[model samples]
Target: MEIKDSVVLVTGANRGIGAEWVHQLRERGAAKIYAGARDPRSVVCPDDRVMPIALDVTARGQVLAAAELANDVQIVVNNAAVSYRQPLIGGDVDRIHAEFETNVFGLVYVTEAFAPVLRANGGGAIVNALSAVSWFSFPGMAGYSATKSAAWNLTDALRLELADQGTLVVALHSGAVTTPMGDNFPIDKIEPTQVVSAALDGLQAGQTEVLADDISRVIKSTLTSDPSRYAAILGG
Candidate 1:
């Protein structure tokens, strides 16, 4: 849980939240950061602690290879995700499939591949990047919401499953961040650096879930009493 001198791996580290996580981790004095990306060459930070690693989370072979390469990694930040602006009933099936491939299935693959490594290293921790959409409906991001909801449950399951091994699992849910993923939205967004910084602090403090923005904090607090409030947007 300690970020200082921790060996960490961050997926989708080329840009957006993932890239910000890499930078923040270095600032936290991480011993090494495996910056996992589809094209590792794109990671341009000059820090020696940053190790750019080629990893396509959707590909089983690539994931296994990355695990082999970053054998010392004790903490994992599953920050890679894909979102397609599509409604469940009206969206293209191909787009929905694509989102699931990266957002849900890919996360599962990465976790599976890294589980042994984490256990071997004395069971450190896993932090999954989720979204506020998992708690409430967004008009055109139903597919993304569905996948993130699955990821949220996945985080819970992993937490319980890995508990005996002493591994900590943290699920982070938040409204849009000021990254490429939220560039098209008009809502107020938190900076990616701030989001990642808060996440690291929460992890070290042994928190299970992190609501990185006010919107996410309010949604999580209100979900139990007003689950139906989200249905209003879905026309329930």
Candidate 2:
């Protein structure tokens, strides 16, 4: 679906890729944008076309409230997520659970609440900000990787289930981005604008999955390979 003149809602829009998406969507001629953040006051977009909404996706009440307020939305961007750095087995289980709360359950809640909204608006689109880690695990980020993997599956399942409704479900997978989420990671990072652009482009082109960067593409290519080989790489 064309983004021009569409009403779009982006979660985590206070900063990072979500913020970039809000700006780029405006540039693409989006009629209205609901920028959702834990603290709506933190959203810096000053346009009247941009409405900042208080939304903590992990909170069911906030999610439902945002959905009600943005019922005219034609597109929903699930960009809010949390990451906890630790090993899987002996890791901080509490932190891992927190990560799942925000990254996995939050996403599900938001999508479920907005599914009907999208249907009412004539079957629009849902964009999920996934990660390269969704395809491969990384040391010290095992919990984060697991959540993203679950999100990837959720995206796929939603795509299939929402097909009859004409709701386009798109998943964008990439390596670390130049955002707070990428802090302390020594690897090269892509700009948030690049990720947003690629995802919007894919949405316009009717793509269900967008591998937004080289790292994501490379990791996805390994899915068909011997599981042991990929496991060794992650283990090392």
Candidate 3:
């Protein structure tokens, strides 16, 4: 899982945390980076080591193509996701489907396509960009939170499934990050660079999960506490 000399692929690399991963990976001496985006032309990294690949994680064909093209990738970062802030009750179900399409199923598609490639490359690592909401729910973000919760369990399953192949599945959880995705939220946010840095550090150190911010750490710690305690906070 050493970043140095590793060939990595990051989904949704056109912007946000994915873009930061490309930058930090280059700084860590990654030999090559396949920056997968829905529109490859949108990838803006200046590093020569970066190769922009057209990939839409929700599309199986595109995911397969990316897996074929980036066969040398030793690390796969599942950073592509969508979030729709809407309540579960009386909310547009379409929005929930959209979030799950990108956040949950898209992740599954990407990982499935790349599992063999990772095994071929000496069982590298898969880093999933999860969220603190995976452990707790917020009113307006019910759908987004549910998708992340699904992704959290998915990561755990993948870890066990890929263990025989030596592939390390790492889940990175955090609250809002300073990106377009977090702009609407007024809460304190972690810089994208900081999230990427902590994730990569955890990956190299063979950690299964890395809580990238205080909110994430706190939320995770409360997972085993009495439900009523958090229920009161959620106004249930």
| Alpha carbon lDDT at 44, candidate 3 | 90
Best by lDDT: 3
Q: Which pairs, if any, clash in model 2?
A: none
Worst 10-residue stretch by lDDT in candidate 1?
226-235
Which residue runs does candidate 3 get wrong by more than 4 Å?
224-236
RMSD of each: 2.4, 2.1, 2.1
The C-alpha TM-scores of every prediction are 0.94, 0.94, 0.95
TM-score of 2: 0.94
Q: Residue-wise lDDT of candidate 3 within 1-236, one digit each (tens)?
A: 79999999999999999999999999999999999999999999696899999999999999998899899999999999988766799999999999999999999999999999999989999999999889887668889989999999999999999999999999999988999988745567889988998999999999999999878887887886466745433436
Show where candidate 2 strays beyond 4 Å: 224-236
By TM-score: ranked, best first: 3, 2, 1
lDDT of each: 0.87, 0.90, 0.91
Give, for candidate 2, the lowest lDDT window spanning 10 residues: 227-236
lDDT of 1 by residue, 67-120 (tens): 988889899999999877656886799988888899998989999999999999
Worst 10 residues of 3 by lDDT: 227-236
Better of 2 and 3 by lDDT: 3
Supply candidate 3's per-residue lDDT for 225: 42
